[model samples]
Target: MVALRIRPAIVLFGDSITEQAFGVEGKVGWASLLASDYARRADVLNRGFSGYNTQMALPLLPKVFPPSKDNQEGSGILFCTVFFGANDACLPGERQHVPIEEYAKNLETIIGTIRACFNIFSSAATKDDDKFPIILMTPPPFDPAAWRKCRDLEEDGRANNVAKSYGEKVLELGKSLGCSVLNVWNLLEGATSPEVYGRYLSDGLHLNEEGNRKVHEGLMELIGKDHPSLAPLEAGATGEGLAVEEKLWRELC
Candidate 1:
């Protein structure tokens, strides 16, 4: 008889959306639901820190790396989802927005750090040719109507505009670095309208259940096309559990 082996799971690093899995009952984040969808196939670790920025994430890469084994080389983490720049674009006089240059540097540091870690862990058996895949996802477009209703329009506009600009730069960086990039901003722009925003956003910025569902479906489609291993998320019944787990992690963290 032959034994079957499982591959290491993917890691998600981001802010509230990623942390949504840890929300209280009935308020699970979309990412958590996504995780549950994949539970039968691959392990999905959600490391979303609410209100965090790229600067903070750049230093947390080590925690996401897989542990080493005794007999064989440590398995590499399959996917890394980098979703940031939200808190960095917080309202004026609140959280300071990271300058474009600094943002780029932070992302570069993250990618470099991950690559370096993979090299150190996998160097014993494999060559540089075998490297884990990394995915860079841009933050979703800020709902302007939602912003106007809940926040100071002028201020929110500035922040959203700034964040959008920086988001584009991040996408460009991803391409240059040879990483797979998901332009979430573009995806959400046309799908959502002012009326939709009013209902799906709790505060014009963060998403409500409907908003989360929309993002989740889009994410599944994107992941399915690019990363078939993650397709299970598109059709699974563990969304509730995944949501609970996400909420737990968020609160505990």
Candidate 2:
């Protein structure tokens, strides 16, 4: 009897940024790029929820990544990206607003859960699965003017200053927790005026085509540099190419 060999999952867990990662209207999203890059090698699962904050994500963790011993569905998580805080950075009275301190704590809790689950699942499979890489992404730059115009509101629900605070916290956590960080905030806003940075966003809050490309490029760069073994296979690839489940048709022929 043959045993089941499941493809390892690259989980993109977060808020609207992740949820919309596959994209719409003929636009390709960062997650979609990953899916293509890892085609036939790994499953890239999008677990993004629009309007969700860290506080809301906490309760969903268990259900999303259950224990492997109980359910093999959670057994082969290659890695996951945590991208939240956009909605959480909303104004004080907003429904999605979570205090900065609480948001930090919530992120810690979420990471802890993933580590625990990954350890259990991988340890059962093999000792070589000792490390589970996690990438924490900071919220992209928020353009209050764009958001106000997009939403047609007197005042935007989020502010750049408030969002920046959240991104900083994510950076701190990445260092302390030894997780790779995709600093979207810096990637989009680095020393640029709002006029320039604002172009990356669609509704001043979400990513546009160029913005998605930036994120996809950043992710590919990180995986190639930091986790080269997991990078997709290509011509003349050395350490960058990960082995696929089966040989290519050309190889078989």
Candidate 3:
């Protein structure tokens, strides 16, 4: 359970990208790095499930982000990033494929649910009162060359172009839903070299350090512009608005 002190949470919800955010083997994932950036300001919750598609991800939202009390005010969800599709775009017969059409619908449903959960504070406010926002991230591009060497190409899975299609659809969904987005697929593609694109993917699937850095940069850009409220508090201030314990340890010692 989250401590009452950390009422607001910056939730990083997605598949393996999230799961590996705070890496176990010493290297930190982008989410963990971002969490450090916002340390003391808010709690960053990681909700990544490896190999999960949208169909598998939808059911888990309510359990993690239940509705707040009707009158509760403030940043309950600081923000959430609904990232999926890496697995959903797997080619037919792969363990993770989901039809592209259904993928769009699933995203809509998830965003709607998120709004409802956060809307518990007011049923009468105009659109202006809605300050919170969710971000949607397109999955990173896949590398066929890496896949060919690491796994059987005949087994079925996505290629970089196929990933681009899914990524574009995600951008469209974000626009129609009025949500922000981080198009990592294109960001990576735009910056990577044709000769070294494989370096970005540790296994033609999971991200490597360079890929994670790209995600971190993309996310920081979005949050800095759209949701500055979620940024780390000034030096010593906590999310609540003041720094009650800034000097506590020194005083106690």
Question: RMSD in Å for candidate 1, one decimal?
Answer: 9.0
- What is candidate 2's CA lDDT for residue 5? 62
What global local distance difference test value does model 1 have? 0.63
Ranking by lDDT: 2, 3, 1
By the lDDT metric, which is better: model 2 or model 3?
Answer: 2
For candidate 3, what is the TM-score?
Answer: 0.83
Best by TM-score: 2
Measured on C-alpha atoms, candidate 2 has an lDDT of 0.84
lDDT of each: 0.63, 0.84, 0.75
Candidate 2 per-residue C-alpha lDDT over 181-222 given as tens digits, one digit per residue, 9 for 90 to 100: 988988897347679999999988899989999999999898
Residue pairs clashing in model 1 are 20-29, 21-246, 21-247, 22-246, 22-247, 22-248, 23-247
TM-scores for every predicted model: 0.71, 0.91, 0.83
lDDT of 1 at 161: 60
Worst 10 residues of 1 by lDDT: 240-249
Model 1 agreement with the true structure over 28-132: per-residue lDDT tens digits: 666767666666556676888887888777667666643333322444455677887766665446664576778788988887777666545542211232544
Question: Could you give me the TM-score of model 2 versus the true structure?
Answer: 0.91
